[model samples]
Target chain A: MKKSVILSILSVFLITIFLGGCGSKDQTTLNVYNWGDYIDSSVIKQFEKETGIKVNYDTFATNEEMYVKINKGNASYDIAIPSDYMIEKMIKEGLVEKIDFNNIPNYQYIEDRFKNLEFDPTNEYSVPYMWGTLGILYNKKMVDEPVDSWDILWNPKYEKQILMLDSQRDSLAVALKKLNYSMNSTNDAELEAAKNALIEQRPLVLAYVGDEVKDKMIGEEAALAVVWGGDAVTMHRENPDLEYVIPKEGTNLFVDSIVIPSTAKHKAEAEKFIDFLCRTDIAFKNTDYIGYSTPHMEARKQLDPELANSPIAYPEPEDLENAEIFIDLGTYIEQYNRVWTEIKSH
Target chain B: MNKKWISAPYLVWMVIFIVVPLFLVGFYGITVRTDTGFVFSLEPLQRCFEPTYLKVLGRSVLLAAISTVICLILGYPIAMILTSKDFSDKNIYLMLFVIPMWMNFLLRTYAWLTLLEKNGLINVLLQKIGLNPIHILYTNQAVVLGMVYNFLPFMVLPIYSVLKKLDSSLIEAAQDLGANGFQTFIKVIFPLSIPGVVSGITMVFMPAVTTFVISRLLGGGHYYLIGNLIEEQFLSVGNWHFGSALSIFLMIIILISIFITSHYETDKEGSVGLW
Candidate 1:
């Protein structure tokens, strides 16, 4: 019995010693957290080659997920890519740190159109990475009609073949747009209208989708989808029959911006990477790979003409007039999420 | 031979796995704050009772109840057959039932997703059979199908064990007393299988009620559940207190289920406590 006890104690000690050795901490490694499939990873390798900062990249599905990781105070991410409303919300809570413009010389390459947006006035806290609208993408073969309106998604004809956005903000924005309501409306009556519209459309929806809609739609599994412009671009890349169209009614124009969360230890390295991403060539590469429109004017010129010409990638200025940026709803966000939950559960 | 040996190890395991986590859950439940930086309160609990979470709870109970009923009805006969005298290779049949449980539950769920999905094998086969390719995925039916498939093995194992231990003489005596096969089964076999049924129901129903992954992948993530609420609170919204409260709420519901199911069995099983 003593021998067995000794053996067990020895085993435990050896295992603890070996496992403890694996917990190595180094100051050189910069941990980056961003949206999944958001950035071209090749650019990260290039940045690593240029500067010997070992970059550990991780991805989250939503802005709130990133916020949870940062705010909960476990993960120490150097850089974060959150959208406009999230940026505003983070800024309000002082969860983001001010950017030092001197570190990022290539910030000048970013287009004036994307700069000084409402989320980050004077581009102080965040840099615009990529921007796009939420819209309809349908198969040209299956959908013979012009498919100009959001109402087409509500039609009974495509009952089992329709895909809607799964994200709370994007999905809710679409519903709000369908009812001719403001994308950022915090009013209860307008929200109720959107909720009722969603409930009506629920029976007709095939799936509430995120990135997977791209693959499922092109494969003809789903005939019509409410997808992000970036995902629509990716789907169209593989299949030429796939066509993306903005609903005649307006949609939410969103910009995902790179910001340093308050918990960042490597703010210097993050700022440098953001600067690297802003370089016209790098931005163009990222845009080409990820299929999101680069917010840089110089990058637009460098983009392939086919991509540049796609209305889905870059809508005309007239089509853009009615598009509104999402604003932080503050206290009303709870109500919005509640409404979202109620609509979904029922 | 030795109750102490069994009791000691069982107690140790319970303390390590169940009791420890439950204590931590209580610790986190009161300590973690809401997104607005407020400390633990009844606010999250109040939020949980809101129509949104209640509807989620309602759907979860509905899906779980239906799945339990379906599994028992399907699993009982298969378990009975496996335990029957006609089946010579009991070990082989038992292993066959047990083997599918060895695969990851998530992978099994995904396999069903592949089957239920549009352009999946089912739809393709339907088209081949000259029938209209039906829309099966992202519906309540798909969610129930996933639950039944995943929990069917769980339902089978308990009933098989009980039926295997069933005395042959009891059924024979029922037959000798002028009862037909159907009457013998109803009077002896079916009544004797209640413990197994109760245990199987307990196992499948609890997991089903709290399950969100299967529903998310198969039902398209639109159908929110209490499990989803807990996930959103802890992982998404960073409200650990709320998540803990939600978990405790699930635990209370589970306890209530056990109490109700136990009461159902008590009237029938008199002295035989289902172990």
Candidate 2:
């Protein structure tokens, strides 16, 4: 009985290995890595149906998590949707491939304003996917005062009723902007003040949250939260009592863009996928479902007029005048890490 | 089939998955990368001893120790009750403890969030009962509660198995010698169960100290445990050297704890008996 069992097991293992070797022989598979819940599932099905290319879709929670995986060179990811700062970092490190814009004719649908940004100044390495501003999402019933300025977050009456972003850069940016300093300030004194401000505000924060900020704000678990404009849009849909505001002081204007890593084996197919995502109907489907601001002008027009005109989703230029895009901090990131650790440990 | 051949696949799996990763972690822990190449450096390990990190390590140990003790206090009685001769439905009661564990650990923890949030079910129930709602979530207490709830099974199963195999003749001899129930438990049963208790504490304490999720979900990110510090280094900061160093240091602490507990477990002379 034992001999027969061993023989069967060995045969099964050999058969599995043989089948796995044959499975990838003929098919052109594209590996797409994106943020969790960033895409509409139907779009992937449609793309596969139209192109007959198999897609291995995976998701990451943060830009850092995605960076480490790609940097390790363990997996050959064909496409990645990383934010502007990360694209800049990847480009500097020679990790990303320059896009062949000729293959991406749908790239013209992207707004001109989203192009020629600081991260990819020549617009060579990446194509804009979505863009938004970081701001405060507050409950109208919980607070009685005007919520226009970042100063309101420091109000003592809202103690233990505020939720700060758990992310280091975003949280520090809020403090930096509130002090009338640049969000990208690397100076010791400026960062020290930001650190001190966060340490003081730590007592007032109910929780340092990430994706849970939306659920908590909608449930009225917290009166105020630091959230991305996109998340704020989703939270408002769930609870109309919630309101989003771009603080008058300034905020981080972030743009997530699609880039092909240099390690990608299927570059041409990845470019095709990027063009598919940029198409008007597909872009509209994604932006509508994901609730992020669409950088595709045609897609924006196709959205509900109420949503298309909403200042939260599509903030006017003057409102973004003070907003600064985050840049790769290089080794200066250690300082922010230190300050964050101190604040969290304290 | 030969025994060695039968175990060959498992041995390969262990070396590839366990030994190789551990070796890599150790390599990164003690080395620093520089302009030329990797060099032997203790900076990452030394950084772990800094005041901030030391406090994080101290908090992790303190909370894990608290949770282990709570599990022991609660679990011992349950194991004793289940192993008692009068308990006829022991399997049914044991199944009750194991059932929740069959569900995903993350899902179970997430469920607690719904019950513990500000306007969550617990608060709603409290308000309806004319009692002020308690702020129990997002606190160290909640983290400890989560640890105890999740790890109680680990503590109970080992003790229950030990007690089940305990010789009945020993108890009968103590009773024949005119010893009462309390005296018999203190002098005979408790000392004999030292191995089980030691293993139980080891299982519960080790995981509790290294748990990032429970503290993250329950402690509201306010309580920065060592696990969270290590996680931030690896995931957010991309500082693998520091993260590996922290992991190595945590492993050493766990090894020392297991060493101490195993010493008690091997002292079969009944030296652990209460006088």
Identify the candidate with maximal TM-score. Answer: 2
Off by over 4 Å in 1: A1-27, A45-50, A279-281, B1-43, B46-52, B85-96, B165-184, B187-192, B235-244, B264-275
- Candidate 2 residue-wise lDDT at A226: 93
Q: Give candidate 1's whole-model lDDT.
A: 0.83
Clashing pairs in 1: none
- Deviation of model 2 at B114, angstroms: 0.8
lDDT for each residue of candidate 1 in B39-114, tens digit (9 for 90 to 100): 6566656666877677888889999999999998899999988988878998887887789889878768867767
DockQ score of the complex predicted as candidate 2: 0.74
Which candidate number would show the highest DockQ if scored against the true structure?
A: 2
* Tens digit of per-residue lDDT, candidate 1, span A66-117: 7888887688888989999999999999999999999999888888888989
If scored against the real structure, what TM-score would every candidate get?
Answer: 0.86, 0.95
A1-346: candidate 2 lDDT, tens digit per residue = 1222233355457546755877755878888888877888799889989998877777676788789889974899999999988899999999999999999999999999999999999999999999999999999999888899888889999999999988888899999999999998989999999999999998888998877777789899999999999988888999999999999999999999999999999999999999999999999999998889999999999999989999999999999999999999988989999999999998
Model 2, B139-180: lDDT tens per residue? 899999999999999999999999999999999999999999
